[model samples]
Target: MTDRRRFADAVFRGARSRRSLRTPHAPLVPRRPPAPPAAPSAPEPETGLETGEPVVFDAFTADLGAGLPTGMALLVVIPVEQGGTPGFRLRAVCCCASLVEFGDVYGRPDLALGSLVAADGLLPVDVLSSMRTWSRTKKGLIRWLDARRAAHGDDLQLVIWDQTGYGIPWELFWLERAPGSGRSEGWLGGLVTVTRWLSIETAWGEVVRDYRSEHTCAGPVAAYVAAEMEHDVSLFGAYHLENSDSLHTLAKALEEGDPLAMVYVACHGTYGARLSDCVLGGVPLDRFDPRRFDRLGPAATFVFLNACHSGSLVDDAGRFRDRALRGFAEVFLRSGAAGVLATSGRVGDRQAHEMADQLFRHLRDHPGRSVAQAVRDLRAEMARMTPDDLLDVDGPEGNRRLLPLLYRFMYVFYGSPRTAVSLATGKGV
Candidate 1:
């Protein structure tokens, strides 16, 4: 236990320092510009999912507790093996109390995660069961949290710092009600505003540095929800850069524009047991060569990366791979975007689209809200939505009712926590 504490202490110290330091944007190295992309392929036919019933991405679990006391929180960093099954040694460090614990993950972490967040191949009941099973295995961690809550009171917040190659959905962990409280078990999202962060060295430093200029530029908001919403420029007001052609062209277009506000993307994403394998659309972010954007000059201040594993990173086996490549979220920050809202893994298309739309609505309707507050409000709003409001049908669909709650917890905000969206009219703060 002493040795574990010492190790966790070291990691916590490093995380603290990195959180404090900011990495200045590296000077753009002179290089040839990227080639133009081929014309966009014809739009595919709309699937029933897209034009189907409105999917309300709810984060509520029975009684979603009022968020932890403002600013008071816990940060847990878990070490994971490469290419290993989702199961891992639970060597975690808690920043709030400087607490550290070593243990094993519950059940087949991979299977539970797949059933809960897998993009395909699982029934709604299977998904719910998988989620419950995953949470059940974490009884040890829950006990630890219960102790902390008892000691520190209910105001303490919970923020998970994911450092593993296989991204675990921390939000799914179920916390039972206090003895005789007469309430059922509740997922972590219900009790607090649960958020996640990357633990790689370079990513943290870049976030610290880029965060300073997160809202420096005042530009129009841009978006590309889907092939159908491509021409809906009014969706975001002024600029709506459709995911036309390819991601390469989108990057090029944003590059040409002066310092812009934010770019929103909604598309299929893929992740592997390895964090480096994460991709947005069809482009792998880790393998993305900085040289590709070398000549680009547009600076997008913030991004809403509504893709799987876009905010994930693993500590390379050793110091050798410490900062080898940037995490998917950091890729945008390094490319001049100061902040990002990303998911740790694959999310259903319905939930993905709902998150994108609601996020924009909150940012637009409430300019006084910072990005963090906007997100919190968004989470709370969705959590507040009753089951009736979210359900289209009563019986069979109700079995999968938890889908909305699952997605609500998948989004993890990266970069400066205080940074908010700045619209072209300069209203959003």
Candidate 2:
């Protein structure tokens, strides 16, 4: 059998054996209070057996844990077919532990999940606040995370490796409050530093990167700002490329062997029917193919695509099924960028600019914080801020606002959560 087949078989057999041999442990701490029951509807038929217990497989663990640094974990989700039914296998591994669980089979497409993505690949923010359906897969993953957090501290950094390409928006998963814990429940992304990765193959070696080395220092930045936002270009203190000619300028920078610390793009982005149609800075995304450029420049550690829908990975059907049509975030990641921060949906123009400003300011002011940690802190801060505080609005507008909370979850980071961007001097990017 091929390597892929062999690996899958081993995982399946190992999961079964492990489940049979070991008794599941109860949570060490009190479980979170259950969410209010949803409106009753016809029950969907089960497609496969549910195994909520964590399974340990040595081969899988070793492969995933080979180069994982301490305090960091990889959550691998792969779509699979068992007995002609489509399902997913969820696995997580850190330096010291491993856990695997089988997710519920997909008998039919999830309309709620599909509703998050619009026809143009942009997310409809209105659907976010009312979302109640939590997939069994998500719940199972949460249980695993709860156990991990209980054993370890909440400082763990998570790298989600999603082979399903469904664009599940893992960061926005609602976390319930632990009873008497005194911690308010919030989005998972705000609670922890989370990043994402996508690999076609099942092998861990194919997707592993040495993140420690990339966390050392901040290098030169290359900023591409729209004409209207030229005022923000000085924030990076790097070569400023106007939006109209950003493509050419970026190409020249790559060809000239310029070592860049960061590539910040502040422009308008629009989703199209296909990946090629997606536009950034008035240029088609197809023009920025990483393969066309000989190099992405040395130390190209971080990319901040501060634009609407720049981070989305969906295709024509508003789903992430078309792997070949990946978004700008994936493009930069494949181009050897250590980390990328982009938006998953439409963002208010003012909020988008403010978000970028806050991010850079936080990075510069706090020299020791990692990009992911800074993002997490910022999300939490935004979540706590009322509209009156954030937008300086009056009581009526402030009480009826949703953008502050919604905008915080729109920004998604894809890379090593622990990868630090040093700005010890606290001066420029």
Candidate 3:
């Protein structure tokens, strides 16, 4: 194995659990997405940041895998599109000793997140079984996972590496039915914890990651939004920045000596060549190097990229170019962030606000909640939301129902599944 693979193996080996594994039931399919409507015009500009007390996090006491599903850890590798053709696949190196599964699911070359929702909403039982079978044969790792889970318990960390910008909502696999009734059950975040990883080779080297970082707190929690997103930024109680310099300064401080719990960024995001062509204030992530903010103190750091396509990794041009990185989220990870919450495709202001509200509220209400668990809660909350919950905007009121569905599986978590922030302690779990 190469040095990067060796590093990944070590990280997962350190996190390997000793619990019994049970095979998962048939996988579930995602809820079908609604037909998309015309895109909305950009919102007006407004700027200012609302700074606040630093959040306290109890890293020493926080359990890395507390409350997480206990089962064989799973790593999946999916294919990305390049120049309208499928490119070499990205693989998920395993941390679980019992099993490491790899699969190749094809995605479009353009990497545009066409629909956030599933096509059928509910996949049939036969299809679910077929999926597992296909994964076993085509991907060549599911059978071992099944056997391990059957022997142990039905819980696994489903780590996904979507370098190609495929829009598959892996969370919606339909697993089973209610014992007596026809009522069907699906595999939402409640049952499975989905974490994303970056697989691009950079100038420094291959960006192999350590997904198990202990939580730590540096100081007070702070937030920043692009000038245009001041309205949404205020929802998170964060001050908005007018340009990239201020954002860079804060990032620099976090890397050097500043105490920062979390940074919320709301701005415009675009995808081409790669994901995260996002502009915060007047600064584009392309011009901003996240590595400049390395060694972010003892406190674990989080970055919420509340921008459309901020996490999209569509184009494959220059993917192997020496300093070329995938998206803003990857940059943050490369720079030293413990975790990042970003959207896979275009997301609206309303949806982004709803996500932020859920994330912060969960952190505020539940001290020491693992970032993975909080995100699990967030995914569950989003799954439960309906169009009725959204405010009617420019689109057809009937079509508005799709908004919540569109947001489903659009947001991805990059970093340690065990990493979490506590507003109460101002530290990472």
Candidate 4:
């Protein structure tokens, strides 16, 4: 009864009812990432920013449960990384160079996609985050997932992202005996976002990102990618409010009793303890809820607040509690998940993407490896490019704005594949 089974009957019906449609090829991986000739400019933080609210990282920790990995509570790195040099990597099209560097390198999870074209003939399956979109030959693929769900007696976990306008070709998963070809294949599509755009001043040759779009790049590219994966996965989403219809669609899906395994919200965060870059849902923030999972099918997992503050705890003063760790990961695990990985500080988008790339590479290339080992590898690579501030620990003391600005936006998830940490706040990472 994996999440996939919960919707199996309905999904097949949706497909069989409309099998005639044009095949949408996954976007060719971008070979050359676009770049601007000049650096970027920053917008002033909105006037409503409550800087007057004293931030207490220690207090935040008390509110959250223990069992969090060290550095699970702080994410002061946004300013650190943005203040430095920026680099660009292509979107979907994986150049020959990337193909050569596949499993062990750094890349964005949702955008810089990599996949294994199953020799048995199935559409490429997104390696990282494990989502599926489009299908040239649907039969065998459907059988495979169906069998997995029934055999596991668990809901299939569907990880979704940026589905604002993406649509999946449901017919692609149906199996059929094609002429002469005994076996059928399916095409899988996934992309990793390198450096997102705040507002593309293509006019100025600049690619930037801001708090508004949740690191969403500007272009039909994102829209196209979103539409591509609309129909598959257990529960898929890279962030909340990704597009106009995202919330609406999510509400509808939940209402219809779809089992959502985990809801990953990897977006703008602050050391002050807010999942959103700006206030939302009444508390100057938004939090994850397990009770909302009415139709989780048969899976024990619920929500994942992969975004920064997702694991951060709040002290009595309402500030972040743990200066060195965020408790959201602990909460996610304590509440229950296969596991949760979170960041204590602002993880750079590029770094996050790269980490995701390595994580997925390890998962696919080295099947059955422990998630801890995967993260270990990712951390090792990230350590290679540590910012100068982190490297110069003796230079200053106590959360230097310049220091966090140097290298804190790193992505970390803290949760057992089946465990969640306790946060009195129950913010849900």
Which one wins on TM-score?
2
2 versus 3: better lDDT goes to: 2
Best by lDDT: 2
Q: Which digits, one per residue and each the tens of the lDDT, describe model 3 over residues 90-188? A: 333333343222324333332223221122121122223333333333334334434433444323455554333344445543344324643323444
The all-Cα superposition gives candidate 3 an RMSD in Å to the true structure of 17.9
Ordering by TM-score: 2, 1, 3, 4
Ranking by lDDT: 2, 1, 3, 4
lDDT of 2 by residue, 335-397 (tens): 566778887755655667678778888987887788889999998887666432423332223
Against the unseen true structure, what C-alpha lDDT does each candidate score?
0.47, 0.55, 0.46, 0.26
Residue 118 of candidate 4: its Cα lDDT? 13
Off by over 4 Å in 3: 1-72, 78-97, 100-155, 163-168, 172-184, 187-190, 200-209, 231-255, 274-280, 295-297, 314-325, 385-398, 424-429
Cα deviation of 197, candidate 3, in Å: 1.2
- Deviation of model 1 at 36, angstroms: 33
Each candidate structure's TM-score, on Cα atoms with residue i matched to residue i, is 0.61, 0.71, 0.61, 0.32
Q: How big is the positional error of residue 68 in model 2, measured in Å on the Cα after superposition?
A: 1.8
Tens-place lDDT digits, model 1, residues 1-429: 554344333322322110011111211111111111111011111112323333232232111122333443444333333233232444333334443443443322453243234423343345445656667656677766665566545344455544333455666566766686443345565554455544322322332322212243346655545453343344565443334455655666665545566777655555443434445556665455342222111543667876555565433333233323346665565554546788755565546666777777887788755565566566555556635343333233443454566567667766544456666652342
| Superposition error at 303 for model 3 (Å) | 1.5
